[model samples]
Target: MIITDTHTHLYSEAFEADRDEMIQRAIDAGISRFFIPAIDSTYSERMLQLKRDFPEHMFLMTGLHPTHVKDDFKDELLHVQTLLKEHKYYAIGEIGIDLYWDQSTLAIQQEAFRQQIQLAKQCNLPIVIHCRDAFDEVFEILEEEKGDDLFGIFHCFTGDFEQAQQAISYNMKLGIGGVVTFKNGKIDQFLNKIDLKHIVLETDSPYLAPVPYRGKRNESFYIMEVLEKLSGLYQLSEKEIAKITTENSKAIFGI
Candidate 1:
Protein backbone atom coordinates (compact mmCIF):
# COMPACT_ATOMS: atom_id res chain seq x y z
CA MET A 1 0.00 0.00 0.00
CA ILE A 2 2.24 2.79 -1.20
CA ILE A 3 0.77 6.26 -0.55
CA THR A 4 1.87 9.57 -2.00
CA ASP A 5 1.83 12.90 -0.19
CA THR A 6 1.70 15.11 -3.30
CA HIS A 7 2.25 18.31 -1.36
CA THR A 8 4.16 18.57 1.95
CA HIS A 9 6.79 20.88 3.33
CA LEU A 10 8.97 18.03 4.56
CA TYR A 11 11.89 20.45 4.65
CA SER A 12 9.99 22.73 6.99
CA GLU A 13 11.65 23.78 10.26
CA ALA A 14 8.71 22.30 12.15
CA PHE A 15 10.37 18.86 11.93
CA GLU A 16 13.90 20.14 12.54
CA ALA A 17 14.29 18.28 15.84
CA ASP A 18 13.29 14.85 14.56
CA ARG A 19 12.90 15.05 10.81
CA ASP A 20 14.42 11.69 10.12
CA GLU A 21 12.34 9.89 12.71
CA MET A 22 9.16 11.53 11.48
CA ILE A 23 9.95 10.65 7.87
CA GLN A 24 10.87 7.10 8.79
CA ARG A 25 7.59 6.76 10.64
CA ALA A 26 5.71 7.69 7.48
CA ILE A 27 7.83 5.33 5.37
CA ASP A 28 7.16 2.48 7.73
CA ALA A 29 3.48 3.30 7.48
CA GLY A 30 3.77 3.05 3.64
CA ILE A 31 3.66 6.76 2.74
CA SER A 32 6.87 6.70 0.74
CA ARG A 33 6.54 9.54 -1.76
CA PHE A 34 6.91 13.12 -0.48
CA PHE A 35 6.63 15.95 -3.02
CA ILE A 36 8.29 19.05 -1.55
CA PRO A 37 7.06 22.48 -2.74
CA ALA A 38 9.27 25.55 -2.92
CA ILE A 39 8.34 28.65 -0.93
CA ASP A 40 11.25 30.97 -1.78
CA SER A 41 14.99 31.09 -2.45
CA THR A 42 15.70 30.98 1.28
CA TYR A 43 14.53 27.36 1.63
CA SER A 44 16.23 26.14 -1.57
CA GLU A 45 19.32 24.81 0.20
CA ARG A 46 17.28 23.04 2.85
CA MET A 47 15.14 21.50 0.09
CA LEU A 48 18.25 20.32 -1.76
CA GLN A 49 19.69 18.80 1.42
CA LEU A 50 16.40 16.99 2.00
CA LYS A 51 16.53 15.55 -1.53
CA ARG A 52 20.10 14.42 -0.94
CA ASP A 53 19.07 12.77 2.33
CA PHE A 54 16.11 10.96 0.81
CA PRO A 55 17.06 10.88 -2.86
CA GLU A 56 14.56 8.14 -3.63
CA HIS A 57 11.60 9.45 -1.68
CA MET A 58 11.91 13.25 -1.95
CA PHE A 59 10.73 15.00 -5.13
CA LEU A 60 11.41 18.74 -5.44
CA MET A 61 9.53 21.69 -7.02
CA THR A 62 10.74 25.24 -7.68
CA GLY A 63 8.52 28.35 -7.50
CA LEU A 64 7.80 31.42 -5.39
CA HIS A 65 4.81 30.98 -3.10
CA PRO A 66 2.00 33.56 -3.20
CA THR A 67 2.38 34.70 0.41
CA HIS A 68 6.09 35.19 -0.17
CA VAL A 69 5.56 37.46 -3.16
CA LYS A 70 6.70 40.96 -2.31
CA ASP A 71 8.50 44.02 -3.66
CA ASP A 72 11.52 41.83 -4.38
CA PHE A 73 9.41 39.23 -6.18
CA LYS A 74 11.19 39.82 -9.48
CA ASP A 75 14.50 38.78 -7.92
CA GLU A 76 12.76 35.77 -6.38
CA LEU A 77 11.33 34.74 -9.77
CA LEU A 78 14.81 35.10 -11.19
CA HIS A 79 16.03 32.73 -8.49
CA VAL A 80 13.32 30.26 -9.49
CA GLN A 81 14.36 30.58 -13.12
CA THR A 82 18.02 30.05 -12.21
CA LEU A 83 17.14 26.99 -10.13
CA LEU A 84 15.15 25.54 -13.01
CA LYS A 85 18.16 25.93 -15.26
CA GLU A 86 20.48 24.28 -12.71
CA HIS A 87 18.40 21.47 -11.23
CA LYS A 88 15.87 18.82 -12.22
CA TYR A 89 12.54 19.66 -10.62
CA TYR A 90 9.33 17.69 -10.87
CA ALA A 91 7.08 20.75 -11.06
CA ILE A 92 6.69 24.52 -10.75
CA GLY A 93 4.51 25.11 -7.78
CA GLU A 94 2.89 25.83 -4.50
CA ILE A 95 2.39 29.01 -6.50
CA GLY A 96 -0.86 30.99 -6.89
CA ILE A 97 -2.80 33.93 -5.46
CA ASP A 98 -3.16 33.92 -1.67
CA LEU A 99 -5.44 36.84 -0.76
CA TYR A 100 -6.04 35.51 2.73
CA TRP A 101 -2.70 36.74 4.01
CA ASP A 102 -2.51 40.15 2.37
CA GLN A 103 -5.10 41.23 -0.14
CA SER A 104 -2.92 44.23 -0.92
CA THR A 105 -0.52 42.00 -2.83
CA LEU A 106 -3.19 40.64 -5.15
CA ALA A 107 -1.84 42.35 -8.26
CA ILE A 108 1.71 41.12 -7.78
CA GLN A 109 0.46 37.70 -6.71
CA GLN A 110 -1.50 37.30 -9.93
CA GLU A 111 1.47 38.37 -11.98
CA ALA A 112 3.77 35.93 -10.23
CA PHE A 113 1.18 33.19 -10.67
CA ARG A 114 0.89 33.88 -14.40
CA GLN A 115 4.66 34.01 -14.88
CA GLN A 116 5.16 30.73 -13.02
CA ILE A 117 2.38 29.04 -14.97
CA GLN A 118 4.13 30.12 -18.17
CA LEU A 119 7.37 28.74 -16.74
CA ALA A 120 5.66 25.43 -16.05
CA LYS A 121 4.46 25.34 -19.62
CA GLN A 122 7.93 26.09 -20.91
CA CYS A 123 9.45 23.28 -18.87
CA ASN A 124 6.65 20.80 -19.67
CA LEU A 125 6.20 20.13 -15.96
CA PRO A 126 3.17 19.91 -13.76
CA ILE A 127 2.30 22.74 -11.34
CA VAL A 128 1.23 22.37 -7.72
CA ILE A 129 -1.04 25.26 -6.78
CA HIS A 130 -1.47 26.90 -3.36
CA CYS A 131 -4.69 28.85 -3.50
CA ARG A 132 -6.42 30.49 -0.57
CA ASP A 133 -9.39 32.88 -0.64
CA ALA A 134 -8.80 33.35 -4.37
CA PHE A 135 -10.58 30.59 -6.22
CA ASP A 136 -12.08 32.96 -8.78
CA GLU A 137 -8.73 34.68 -9.19
CA VAL A 138 -6.92 31.38 -9.64
CA PHE A 139 -9.56 30.01 -11.99
CA GLU A 140 -9.44 33.17 -14.09
CA ILE A 141 -5.74 32.67 -14.81
CA LEU A 142 -6.26 28.95 -15.36
CA GLU A 143 -8.98 29.79 -17.83
CA GLU A 144 -6.66 32.06 -19.74
CA GLU A 145 -3.89 29.44 -19.72
CA LYS A 146 -5.77 26.17 -20.06
CA GLY A 147 -4.34 23.75 -22.60
CA ASP A 148 -2.43 20.49 -23.05
CA ASP A 149 0.71 21.90 -21.42
CA LEU A 150 -1.05 23.22 -18.31
CA PHE A 151 -1.75 20.40 -15.89
CA GLY A 152 -1.08 19.72 -12.21
CA ILE A 153 -2.49 19.23 -8.73
CA PHE A 154 -4.58 21.80 -6.91
CA HIS A 155 -2.80 21.37 -3.61
CA CYS A 156 -4.92 21.53 -0.47
CA PHE A 157 -8.09 22.14 -2.48
CA THR A 158 -10.95 23.60 -0.41
CA GLY A 159 -13.81 24.45 -2.72
CA ASP A 160 -17.38 23.60 -3.61
CA PHE A 161 -18.55 21.00 -6.18
CA GLU A 162 -18.60 23.57 -8.98
CA GLN A 163 -15.10 24.76 -8.18
CA ALA A 164 -13.87 21.19 -7.97
CA GLN A 165 -15.34 20.47 -11.38
CA GLN A 166 -13.84 23.67 -12.72
CA ALA A 167 -10.43 22.73 -11.33
CA ILE A 168 -10.83 19.36 -13.02
CA SER A 169 -11.62 21.10 -16.28
CA TYR A 170 -8.18 22.65 -16.06
CA ASN A 171 -6.46 19.24 -15.72
CA MET A 172 -5.95 19.51 -11.95
CA LYS A 173 -6.30 16.63 -9.58
CA LEU A 174 -7.85 17.67 -6.27
CA GLY A 175 -5.32 17.28 -3.48
CA ILE A 176 -7.28 15.93 -0.51
CA GLY A 177 -5.59 16.33 2.83
CA GLY A 178 -6.24 16.29 6.59
CA VAL A 179 -9.12 18.69 6.02
CA VAL A 180 -11.17 15.78 4.70
CA THR A 181 -11.11 14.32 8.19
CA PHE A 182 -12.40 17.44 9.91
CA LYS A 183 -16.05 17.30 10.92
CA ASN A 184 -16.75 20.67 9.35
CA GLY A 185 -14.32 20.43 6.46
CA LYS A 186 -17.01 20.54 3.79
CA ILE A 187 -14.98 18.85 1.04
CA ASP A 188 -15.88 15.50 2.57
CA GLN A 189 -19.56 16.16 1.94
CA PHE A 190 -19.26 16.01 -1.87
CA LEU A 191 -15.99 14.09 -2.23
CA ASN A 192 -17.73 10.79 -2.78
CA LYS A 193 -19.44 12.26 -5.79
CA ILE A 194 -16.10 12.95 -7.45
CA ASP A 195 -14.41 9.96 -8.98
CA LEU A 196 -11.39 8.56 -7.14
CA LYS A 197 -9.29 9.23 -10.26
CA HIS A 198 -9.69 12.96 -9.70
CA ILE A 199 -8.47 12.79 -6.11
CA VAL A 200 -5.07 12.43 -4.38
CA LEU A 201 -4.16 12.24 -0.70
CA GLU A 202 -1.90 14.58 1.27
CA THR A 203 -1.25 15.72 4.84
CA ASP A 204 0.13 19.25 4.32
CA SER A 205 2.03 18.14 7.38
CA PRO A 206 3.11 20.27 10.33
CA TYR A 207 -0.05 22.15 9.28
CA LEU A 208 -3.60 20.86 8.72
CA ALA A 209 -3.36 17.73 10.86
CA PRO A 210 -6.27 15.29 10.63
CA VAL A 211 -8.80 14.98 13.41
CA PRO A 212 -7.57 12.88 16.33
CA TYR A 213 -4.36 14.79 15.59
CA ARG A 214 -6.10 18.03 14.69
CA GLY A 215 -4.93 21.22 16.47
CA LYS A 216 -1.54 19.53 16.83
CA ARG A 217 1.52 19.45 14.61
CA ASN A 218 0.97 16.95 11.78
CA GLU A 219 3.42 14.39 10.41
CA SER A 220 3.30 12.30 7.23
CA PHE A 221 2.52 9.19 9.26
CA TYR A 222 -0.65 10.92 10.39
CA ILE A 223 -1.73 10.76 6.74
CA MET A 224 -3.10 7.37 7.64
CA GLU A 225 -5.92 9.14 9.43
CA VAL A 226 -6.70 10.93 6.17
CA LEU A 227 -6.60 7.68 4.23
CA GLU A 228 -9.00 6.05 6.68
CA LYS A 229 -11.41 8.94 6.35
CA LEU A 230 -11.23 8.79 2.55
CA SER A 231 -11.80 5.06 2.61
CA GLY A 232 -15.10 5.57 4.40
CA LEU A 233 -16.12 8.51 2.22
CA TYR A 234 -15.39 6.64 -1.00
CA GLN A 235 -16.55 3.22 0.18
CA LEU A 236 -13.25 1.66 -0.79
CA SER A 237 -10.68 -0.22 1.26
CA GLU A 238 -7.75 1.73 2.65
CA LYS A 239 -5.27 -0.13 0.46
CA GLU A 240 -7.39 0.56 -2.62
CA ILE A 241 -7.62 4.22 -1.78
CA ALA A 242 -3.87 4.41 -1.32
CA LYS A 243 -3.23 2.64 -4.60
CA ILE A 244 -5.64 4.79 -6.57
CA THR A 245 -4.50 8.09 -5.08
CA THR A 246 -0.84 7.19 -5.42
CA GLU A 247 -1.50 6.35 -9.02
CA ASN A 248 -3.36 9.63 -9.40
CA SER A 249 -0.27 11.36 -8.01
CA LYS A 250 1.95 9.56 -10.50
CA ALA A 251 -0.36 10.72 -13.25
CA ILE A 252 0.19 14.30 -12.16
CA PHE A 253 3.86 14.30 -11.05
CA GLY A 254 4.97 11.89 -13.80
CA ILE A 255 6.95 9.84 -11.28
Candidate 2:
Protein backbone atom coordinates (compact mmCIF):
# COMPACT_ATOMS: atom_id res chain seq x y z
CA MET A 1 0.00 0.00 0.00
CA ILE A 2 1.40 3.39 -0.99
CA ILE A 3 0.08 5.68 1.72
CA THR A 4 0.19 9.43 1.16
CA ASP A 5 0.53 11.92 4.01
CA THR A 6 -0.82 14.97 2.13
CA HIS A 7 0.23 17.40 4.84
CA THR A 8 3.15 16.97 7.31
CA HIS A 9 5.93 19.19 8.52
CA LEU A 10 8.51 16.44 8.01
CA TYR A 11 11.04 19.24 8.10
CA SER A 12 9.90 20.20 11.57
CA GLU A 13 12.54 20.52 14.26
CA ALA A 14 10.59 17.97 16.27
CA PHE A 15 12.32 15.21 14.34
CA GLU A 16 15.70 16.92 14.11
CA ALA A 17 17.51 14.33 16.25
CA ASP A 18 16.41 11.33 14.19
CA ARG A 19 14.76 12.65 11.06
CA ASP A 20 16.16 9.99 8.75
CA GLU A 21 15.28 7.11 11.06
CA MET A 22 11.81 8.53 11.59
CA ILE A 23 11.19 8.94 7.85
CA GLN A 24 12.63 5.53 7.12
CA ARG A 25 10.29 4.06 9.72
CA ALA A 26 7.34 5.52 7.84
CA ILE A 27 8.67 4.32 4.48
CA ASP A 28 9.16 0.85 5.89
CA ALA A 29 5.53 0.99 6.98
CA GLY A 30 4.48 1.95 3.41
CA ILE A 31 3.87 5.66 3.99
CA SER A 32 5.93 6.79 1.02
CA ARG A 33 4.54 10.11 -0.19
CA PHE A 34 5.10 13.20 1.96
CA PHE A 35 3.68 16.59 0.91
CA ILE A 36 5.54 19.35 2.77
CA PRO A 37 3.75 22.68 3.29
CA ALA A 38 5.56 26.00 3.54
CA ILE A 39 5.15 28.15 6.63
CA ASP A 40 7.41 31.09 5.75
CA SER A 41 10.67 32.03 4.05
CA THR A 42 12.62 30.88 7.09
CA TYR A 43 11.87 27.22 6.51
CA SER A 44 12.43 27.35 2.75
CA GLU A 45 15.99 26.09 2.88
CA ARG A 46 15.15 23.30 5.29
CA MET A 47 12.26 22.28 3.00
CA LEU A 48 14.58 22.28 -0.01
CA GLN A 49 17.14 20.18 1.83
CA LEU A 50 14.43 17.69 2.80
CA LYS A 51 13.41 17.43 -0.87
CA ARG A 52 16.98 16.83 -1.87
CA ASP A 53 17.44 14.18 0.81
CA PHE A 54 14.32 12.27 -0.15
CA PRO A 55 13.61 13.45 -3.67
CA GLU A 56 11.40 10.49 -4.49
CA HIS A 57 9.10 10.93 -1.48
CA MET A 58 9.01 14.67 -0.79
CA PHE A 59 6.77 17.12 -2.67
CA LEU A 60 6.98 20.82 -1.75
CA MET A 61 4.46 23.68 -1.49
CA THR A 62 5.10 27.42 -1.23
CA GLY A 63 2.92 29.84 0.75
CA LEU A 64 2.79 31.94 3.90
CA HIS A 65 0.81 30.29 6.68
CA PRO A 66 -2.01 32.25 8.32
CA THR A 67 -0.50 32.31 11.80
CA HIS A 68 2.72 33.59 10.31
CA VAL A 69 1.04 36.54 8.62
CA LYS A 70 2.16 39.78 10.21
CA ASP A 71 3.13 43.39 9.45
CA ASP A 72 5.82 42.06 7.07
CA PHE A 73 3.31 39.76 5.34
CA LYS A 74 3.62 41.55 2.02
CA ASP A 75 7.33 40.86 1.93
CA GLU A 76 6.64 37.23 2.89
CA LEU A 77 4.14 36.97 0.04
CA LEU A 78 6.77 38.37 -2.28
CA HIS A 79 9.14 35.66 -1.09
CA VAL A 80 6.48 33.05 -1.85
CA GLN A 81 5.93 34.56 -5.29
CA THR A 82 9.66 34.55 -5.95
CA LEU A 83 9.92 30.92 -4.83
CA LEU A 84 7.12 30.01 -7.22
CA LYS A 85 9.04 31.58 -10.06
CA GLU A 86 12.20 29.70 -9.15
CA HIS A 87 10.97 26.23 -8.16
CA LYS A 88 8.41 23.60 -9.08
CA TYR A 89 5.82 23.32 -6.29
CA TYR A 90 2.85 20.99 -6.11
CA ALA A 91 0.53 23.58 -4.51
CA ILE A 92 0.09 26.95 -2.82
CA GLY A 93 -0.88 26.20 0.70
CA GLU A 94 -1.24 25.55 4.38
CA ILE A 95 -2.60 29.06 3.85
CA GLY A 96 -5.87 30.51 5.17
CA ILE A 97 -7.30 32.47 8.10
CA ASP A 98 -6.35 31.24 11.57
CA LEU A 99 -8.26 33.33 14.11
CA TYR A 100 -7.55 30.94 16.95
CA TRP A 101 -4.04 32.27 17.44
CA ASP A 102 -4.62 36.00 17.19
CA GLN A 103 -8.03 37.38 16.24
CA SER A 104 -6.43 40.79 15.98
CA THR A 105 -4.73 39.79 12.74
CA LEU A 106 -8.02 38.90 11.08
CA ALA A 107 -7.92 41.72 8.55
CA ILE A 108 -4.41 40.97 7.35
CA GLN A 109 -5.11 37.24 7.47
CA GLN A 110 -8.11 37.68 5.18
CA GLU A 111 -6.08 39.74 2.77
CA ALA A 112 -3.26 37.21 2.74
CA PHE A 113 -5.68 34.35 2.24
CA ARG A 114 -7.39 36.14 -0.66
CA GLN A 115 -4.08 36.99 -2.29
CA GLN A 116 -2.78 33.45 -1.98
CA ILE A 117 -5.97 32.02 -3.42
CA GLN A 118 -5.54 34.34 -6.39
CA LEU A 119 -1.94 33.24 -6.65
CA ALA A 120 -3.03 29.60 -6.66
CA LYS A 121 -5.44 30.38 -9.49
CA GLN A 122 -2.68 32.05 -11.46
CA CYS A 123 -0.38 29.05 -11.11
CA ASN A 124 -3.09 26.47 -11.83
CA LEU A 125 -2.10 24.59 -8.67
CA PRO A 126 -4.15 23.09 -5.88
CA ILE A 127 -4.18 24.85 -2.48
CA VAL A 128 -3.92 23.12 0.90
CA ILE A 129 -5.79 25.20 3.47
CA HIS A 130 -5.05 25.57 7.20
CA CYS A 131 -8.19 26.88 8.85
CA ARG A 132 -8.84 27.15 12.56
CA ASP A 133 -11.70 28.83 14.43
CA ALA A 134 -12.58 30.49 11.14
CA PHE A 135 -14.83 28.15 9.23
CA ASP A 136 -17.37 30.89 8.58
CA GLU A 137 -14.60 33.25 7.58
CA VAL A 138 -12.87 30.67 5.38
CA PHE A 139 -16.14 29.64 3.74
CA GLU A 140 -17.01 33.27 3.06
CA ILE A 141 -13.80 33.74 1.12
CA LEU A 142 -14.23 30.40 -0.61
CA GLU A 143 -17.77 31.40 -1.52
CA GLU A 144 -16.45 34.51 -3.22
CA GLU A 145 -13.71 32.58 -5.05
CA LYS A 146 -15.53 29.35 -5.99
CA GLY A 147 -15.08 28.23 -9.58
CA ASP A 148 -13.84 25.38 -11.77
CA ASP A 149 -10.31 26.72 -11.45
CA LEU A 150 -10.17 26.76 -7.64
CA PHE A 151 -9.63 23.32 -6.16
CA GLY A 152 -7.61 21.72 -3.33
CA ILE A 153 -7.65 19.95 0.03
CA PHE A 154 -9.07 21.48 3.21
CA HIS A 155 -6.21 20.47 5.48
CA CYS A 156 -7.05 19.16 8.94
CA PHE A 157 -10.75 19.73 8.40
CA THR A 158 -12.72 19.93 11.66
CA GLY A 159 -16.29 20.89 10.85
CA ASP A 160 -19.86 19.69 10.90
CA PHE A 161 -21.71 17.84 8.13
CA GLU A 162 -23.00 21.13 6.73
CA GLN A 163 -19.51 22.64 6.59
CA ALA A 164 -18.08 19.44 5.10
CA GLN A 165 -20.65 19.59 2.33
CA GLN A 166 -19.91 23.26 1.80
CA ALA A 167 -16.20 22.54 1.60
CA ILE A 168 -16.95 19.85 -0.97
CA SER A 169 -18.94 22.37 -2.97
CA TYR A 170 -15.71 24.33 -3.36
CA ASN A 171 -13.78 21.37 -4.86
CA MET A 172 -11.97 20.52 -1.63
CA LYS A 173 -11.22 16.99 -0.48
CA LEU A 174 -11.55 16.70 3.30
CA GLY A 175 -8.15 15.92 4.80
CA ILE A 176 -8.82 13.32 7.51
CA GLY A 177 -6.06 12.98 10.03
CA GLY A 178 -5.36 11.66 13.57
CA VAL A 179 -8.39 13.58 14.76
CA VAL A 180 -10.60 10.91 13.24
CA THR A 181 -9.20 8.47 15.78
CA PHE A 182 -10.00 10.63 18.78
CA LYS A 183 -13.04 9.53 20.78
CA ASN A 184 -14.47 13.03 20.73
CA GLY A 185 -13.22 14.06 17.32
CA LYS A 186 -16.68 14.51 15.78
CA ILE A 187 -15.66 14.13 12.12
CA ASP A 188 -15.75 10.35 12.59
CA GLN A 189 -19.47 10.55 13.33
CA PHE A 190 -20.46 11.62 9.83
CA LEU A 191 -17.43 10.59 7.80
CA ASN A 192 -18.95 7.46 6.31
CA LYS A 193 -21.85 9.51 5.01
CA ILE A 194 -19.39 11.34 2.80
CA ASP A 195 -18.06 9.23 -0.04
CA LEU A 196 -14.52 7.91 0.24
CA LYS A 197 -13.65 9.84 -2.93
CA HIS A 198 -14.12 13.09 -1.02
CA ILE A 199 -11.64 12.07 1.67
CA VAL A 200 -7.83 11.82 1.93
CA LEU A 201 -5.53 10.59 4.72
CA GLU A 202 -3.02 12.64 6.71
CA THR A 203 -1.26 12.68 10.08
CA ASP A 204 -0.36 16.39 10.51
CA SER A 205 2.49 14.67 12.31
CA PRO A 206 4.53 15.89 15.30
CA TYR A 207 1.07 17.34 16.01
CA LEU A 208 -2.33 15.57 16.13
CA ALA A 209 -1.23 12.02 16.88
CA PRO A 210 -3.84 9.24 16.64
CA VAL A 211 -5.19 7.32 19.63
CA PRO A 212 -2.78 4.85 21.29
CA TYR A 213 -0.35 7.61 20.39
CA ARG A 214 -2.53 10.58 21.25
CA GLY A 215 -0.96 13.25 23.50
CA LYS A 216 2.42 12.17 22.18
CA ARG A 217 4.49 13.34 19.23
CA ASN A 218 3.15 11.83 15.98
CA GLU A 219 5.09 10.33 13.11
CA SER A 220 4.09 9.37 9.56
CA PHE A 221 4.27 5.67 10.40
CA TYR A 222 1.66 6.31 13.11
CA ILE A 223 -0.74 7.13 10.26
CA MET A 224 -1.50 3.42 10.33
CA GLU A 225 -3.60 4.10 13.43
CA VAL A 226 -5.62 6.61 11.42
CA LEU A 227 -5.99 4.14 8.56
CA GLU A 228 -7.30 1.49 10.94
CA LYS A 229 -9.84 3.92 12.41
CA LEU A 230 -11.02 4.94 8.96
CA SER A 231 -11.33 1.31 7.92
CA GLY A 232 -13.81 0.70 10.72
CA LEU A 233 -15.68 3.96 10.12
CA TYR A 234 -16.05 3.31 6.38
CA GLN A 235 -16.46 -0.50 6.63
CA LEU A 236 -13.59 -1.06 4.23
CA SER A 237 -10.37 -3.02 4.61
CA GLU A 238 -7.26 -1.14 5.70
CA LYS A 239 -5.58 -1.76 2.32
CA GLU A 240 -8.64 -0.47 0.51
CA ILE A 241 -8.75 2.66 2.65
CA ALA A 242 -5.08 3.30 2.00
CA LYS A 243 -5.55 2.79 -1.74
CA ILE A 244 -8.58 5.06 -1.95
CA THR A 245 -7.15 7.83 0.21
CA THR A 246 -3.79 7.69 -1.55
CA GLU A 247 -5.63 7.97 -4.85
CA ASN A 248 -7.59 10.88 -3.43
CA SER A 249 -4.29 12.53 -2.55
CA LYS A 250 -3.09 12.00 -6.11
CA ALA A 251 -6.28 13.56 -7.40
CA ILE A 252 -5.62 16.70 -5.36
CA PHE A 253 -1.81 16.94 -5.60
CA GLY A 254 -1.63 15.80 -9.26
CA ILE A 255 1.16 13.37 -8.37
Every model's Cα RMSD, please?
0.7, 0.6
Which residue pairs collide in model 2, if any?
none
Q: Which residues of candidate 1, in runs, are more than 4 Å off? A: none
Query: Clashing pairs in model 1?
Result: none
| Full-model lDDT for every candidate | 0.94, 0.94
Question: Mind giving the per-residue lDDT tens digits that candidate 2 earns over 1-255?
Answer: 899999899999999999999999999999999999999999999999999999999999999999999999999999999999988899998899998889999999999999999999999999999999999999999999999989999999999999999999999999999999888999999999999999998889889999999999999999899899989998999999999999998988889
Compose the digit string of candidate 1's lDDT tens values, residues 1-255: 899988889988999999999999999988899999999999999999999999999999999999999999999999999999998899998899998989999999999999999999999999999999999999999999999999999999899999999999999999999999888889999999999999998888889999998999988998899899999988899999999999999988889
Give the TM-score comparing model 1 with the true structure, all chains together: 0.99
Reference-based TM-score of each model: 0.99, 0.99
| Candidate 2 residue spans exceeding 4 A from truth | none
- Candidate 2 has its poorest 10 consecutive residues by lDDT at 245-254
